[model samples]
Target: DPIFLSSFWQELFTLQGVLLHKSTAYHPQTDGQTEVLNRTLETSLRCFCSDSPHTWATQLPLAEWWYNTTYHSTLKCAPFEVLYGQKPPIHLPYLAGESSNDMVDRSLEAREAVIALLKLHLTRAQQSMRDKANKHRSDRQFMEGDWVYLKL
Candidate 1:
């Protein structure tokens, strides 16, 4: 676990513009997003490798791909779209009458539409999350040196 606090990991996150926050021990809720993603990943792995549990590792990439491309309730858009500004294309079997040029054109058009939709979804999702969080938040304030019990 100490390895996670090493300079290498810290530098890696810094380069990616990620801030690593250490959560309280035994408090998974403190990192709610990670907990939810982990649960989703587990469910995806189960669905993908139910018949061959030993092959779960091999199916991990596919599961991750599916998870990223799937729409999330909180985000209101696929994670892939939010990050890349477009939905990832699924490989479908070519139709007998479809030309490569047509496929390419359709793909580009679809990407544009996905990016537009993702923008709207992101705005709505942010507002929804803000409202939900505010609903349960307390107005209590604590100043420096104020006595507070730390949960162990």
Candidate 2:
């Protein structure tokens, strides 16, 4: 199952113009931020909804929206806001009175703004991932008289 899933992930990445370079899997650490967020989501939904076990499927999206729109414990800003420098439009109501239909013009401007923000987010995320990977490699590099596990 893992082999098949790995190949699938590789293929998916290849479609995105990325190459799969495999060596050994790195041990995962329990990052506090992620753990806290997961716990918050689970607890919130468990307390809020009790009708179905599939409640997670319904609540997860809302939970993500709330989480991303609210300030992070460490980051000091909402995750989406931090990434994009502003929160994306959550909900809005249309007004009844309009003369020249400025709504269309504003919508186009908003779309262009979103595209620009997305490009910026992608660039930043890529750089962050690259930095983490490089740091991991540097930390794991074997030194003289140091013992390391060989992945055989």
Candidate 3:
């Protein structure tokens, strides 16, 4: 709270176009998307820091990078893609005891799998949006002499 209330923090937020809103106690629904992202980031951090815990600070950057590179169904691409106007650069992640060739193959396979998953997610998201939009819509017919708006 003190950090957010500081003049420096206020200026930084203003520069970034971030508007801080007062959150209600025990009301996560008010910021559903933010809450979802927080939960995801927390889960990823927990996974990364489970062994060392104290090494979370070191793992934070990698986790952040991984998150930015991951595909988003709504966006139809990773956040990195939107910001950089291209896909995240491909690289072989370190795998203990694996040779360079094996690592390269694994990296390629992982990317292919991620691409497939992104496609699947996009299809589902589209269907969900269509269903939600259809909820308030109905087929209508107009005929001669049907009531319609007229300019006075």
Candidate 4:
């Protein structure tokens, strides 16, 4: 993790005009969204590297791509699309619909239908994930100076 704070990364970010804001340590739920995303990514890495733990560093790019291109219910679009104003050119295997034609038709109607179906599937998947995550969660409120345990 120290590599992220190294001079090489700092120089690259500076050359690209990117700003890096460090997060505070020992803070309690200052940014719940970030906390949730970090937990999700950690679980993903655990599963992905469970077999070959040493290969995780090499697999990070693939994880990042999957996250960026996946539908975010809150955003209503993939993160990549929001940043680029267009969908990322990721070629997933064509769904085996009714049948396949030797010659593909490059028509607007076909593209529109495909986009619509994709949107529907992504929405459903998002709902499913939300449902599963909320199943074990409860509405809990804590006040200042409440005795609570931190997971660290």
The most accurate candidate by lDDT is: 3
- The candidate 4 region of ten consecutive residues with least summed lDDT is 105-114
Local distance difference test scores for all models? 0.73, 0.62, 0.74, 0.69
The residue ranges of model 1 lying beyond 4 angstroms of the native Cα positions read 1-21, 24-29, 94-152
lDDT of 2 by residue, 46-141 (tens): 543443546456556655776678777688778898889886676543333432577775654544443345456558779999998898575456
Question: Clashing residue pairs, candidate 3?
Answer: none
Using alpha carbons, what is the TM-score of model 4? 0.42
Model 3: number of backbone collisions: 0
Between candidates 1 and 3, name the one with more favorable lDDT. Answer: 3
lDDT of 3 by residue, 1-152 (tens): 67797999999999999999877767888888879987888766666565456866766666688799999999999999999999999855454436468767665564444434545656877999999999998888889999977669
Better of 2 and 3 by lDDT: 3
* TM-score per candidate, chains pooled: 0.44, 0.38, 0.44, 0.42
**Candidate 4 off by > 4 Å:** 1-28, 92-152
RMSD of each: 15.0, 18.3, 9.8, 13.6
Arrange candidates by TM-score, highest first: which order? 1, 3, 4, 2
* Residue pairs in clash, model 1: none
Where model 2 places Cα greater than 4 Å from the true spot, the runs are: 1-29, 90-152
> How far in Å is the alpha carbon of 115 misplaced in model 3?
19
**On residues 42-128, what C-alpha lDDT tens digit does candidate 4 reach at each position?**
655555565566866755565577678889999999999999999989654444353355335333334434445545656877999
